[model samples]
Target: MFVSKRTFSTYRALFHENPLGLPRHKPAPTIPRAHRGLPKKMPIAGVKNVVVVASGKGGVGKSTTAVNIALAAAGLKRRVGILDADIFGPSVPKLMNLKGEPELTEKGDRLIPLTNYGVKCMSMGFLVDQDAPVVWRGLMVMKALQQLLHQVDWGQLDLLVIDMPPGTGDVQLTISQQIVVDGAVIISTPQDIALIDAVKGVNMFKKVNVPILGMVQNMSLFICPNCQHESHIFGHDGAARMAEEFNVPLLGQVPLHADICTLSDSGKPIVISQPDSPFSNYYRSITQNMLNRLQEIK
Candidate 1:
């Protein structure tokens, strides 16, 4: 309810009689359509077919897998873009060998994403110094994410890969709740601790009604080139077992390839540099499975 003009004079006269530094009240500011609370994570918008690559925990080659899969999608002649939403540790810029900051186009306020290996890429590393620590609060992180989503002109893309932070907490919720994600890919190491966390991640997406594309097994095997023998370092088919138990598809398994880590960390994805490598073939197969799954869903 608003005060009428006739009543405004009465309140002003009353405040003047008191003369105790009390001023007449005015109308309140605009109220939003939705009530907002203090969120540990911020919701974002303006993305199409956002595919979140999530894991239960960290240090499981999640980021590397995301990069490779993104490249694989691009290989199909589809327009693809990747958003490095990992605030704590952003490795996309380095993995794709993208250098320099994103160029601001003069026409629209669209941020021109840097390209490497035929895929558009964006990362927090591109905004700040490489060695600088991102000591930002939730709101700050939210603002940054919002800018990345809206400010960047991604153009028309078939899929946008979001490499979410490794956890089921605030950052994860912020991305899940705010963005219209098509599906999620859970990456897990073949171990007890990682699988436990991976299950939690899968459930989190389920609660929010996001479809599980499948679970990918990383570091499932290690084949030494010297002997050309395969060894189960983390145990075989752990991810496949978990997927069956959870009633989700086991998308594919990736071996613990030394070259994948070495090439990605150095900013040259193995798919682009060594297209004939076995690791690249695994990722390519996973991409095809995802396509088939999408068709089934439709």
Candidate 2:
């Protein structure tokens, strides 16, 4: 009756080895020979869908959206994971409220992901000091990313949401070429400058043949708490217009709210911290729409 949550989770992990909740553990289907040579997408052992949340540049709330989306999907009873691929500025550890180096498996070959809020997480932030700077060259960065991607024992996850570094860079290219990403979600504010970078992101993904799941217009609107007046602080419908022009679906919009910022800073994403709130609903709806689209595509 007084079981600690960690103990219970460990018990569950041991007893419930079926991380995907499948009837029986089976190997994933092989990639056909015809498709094998196409950019050589390497499938993660136990992950089915790999969704990358990306932005054209930094400071657009991309990591925040990625964390909330992973939490929201986990709330729907799916085994979810998040990989913070931003080596220079990893935020998943802070956003997920996890720290320290992850534990090794019994064989001591792979890293076990740290868990929080029912979502397993991995990031370079856990391996180094928070204040330390990552000044590695591109080759070193790619090696680190490869370890994070392939050396983690992620178990059986329905979806692995990657919080990608901003811009079309080495890490992004490495992931696109090495991982069989199911789809990508682009995040951008409504400002013209942000959208301009967002366009570059869309083009990059398109060039790599990664399906654009949709675009999320973050900080789309702001509501005055006192007068209930609405304002387009960053300008309005820019993401929607971009989505339409580029033939990508406009997944959803997240309002600029004080609570969103506070909760995120506190390592409690709004989706889990205030599930009943309107802001949580925005994230949940986007998750649902994304699930629906994945289903349709399959």
Candidate 3:
């Protein structure tokens, strides 16, 4: 099934390199906003690259992957910041247990991002009530995203990870069309429904002329707890085949581990809390690959 899909994509590539041809629901919908405000366009100096972690649909562990990958970058002893661009469902604060609003530096109204696990973090949750509905219009969301990138002073070094809202929506398009994304990492499980959307996501970036770092197969496998046997919970290698079809790098395959769920909910990522764990090691390797790619991209 996977191979056939790729073959079609390859054939279609001639018509146009539409990485994301079309979403399952015909045309993708843009969120409604009363006003269309121009996003404040400003790049943080010394921040080498901006990498966005996105997916065709939600609930594919995109946020979790973004948080862990950012944590992994910090483990490499580099300054990092995560922008919780998922305004409607901000999870960076909870995933990393980053509490409190960013403090203001003495630099005359300059707001400083909060630090955790040696990484600077910022999120909408910290700014307002976590559980309260965002009640934001599209234009407002864009304005907020822009403020995060410009208003805050993300000091020096390494990369910035933007945990984008799911799907190819107005906000995502606004960012991709405006912000100079260094690259994008699309996350998906091994299911047709998920992959279909994942393809849409990959193609969305492609349409915007953004570099696709690769496809991340989250929940590629599930190891039984009692017997230690691996099971193809979602199926196998769909992402790998997709990567081959698109000629993008297949960075790594992360399994469904019990520890990842438990530790992450406790604000302890497997990478930081259990560095020796297999899952943690896998993330480290993926992060290294991402870093090497970033260097090559530069």
Which candidate number would show the highest lDDT if scored against the true structure?
2
**Candidate 3 lDDT (Cα, 0 to 1):** 0.76
Residue 282, model 3: lDDT of: 83
Candidate closest to the true structure, highest TM-score: 2
Off by over 4 Å in 2: 1-39
Model 3 steric clash pairs: 19-203, 20-203
Per-residue lDDT for 1-298 in model 3, tens only? 1221222122223322221121122222233443875443335666788999998889888988988899898889877888888778888898888876555544323346778888888887776656678675656666556555555668885889999888898768777765668999989898778999999998889987789988889999998878889998888888888989999888898999788888888988888899888998888888888788777877
TM-score of each: 0.83, 0.87, 0.84
* Model 1 lDDT tens row, 75-188: 988788899988768989888887676655444234567888778888877766689787867666665565565556577788889898888986777667655678899999
Between 1 and 2, whose TM-score is larger? 2
Candidates sorted on TM-score, descending: 2, 3, 1
Stretches > 4 Å off in candidate 3: 1-42
Against the true structure, candidate 3 reaches a TM-score of 0.84
Would you list the clashing residue pairs of candidate 2?
Answer: none
Instruction: Write model 2 residue lDDT over 193-255, tens digit each, in one string.
Output: 999999999999999989999999999999776776789989989999999999988899999
Prediction-by-prediction clash tally: 0, 0, 2
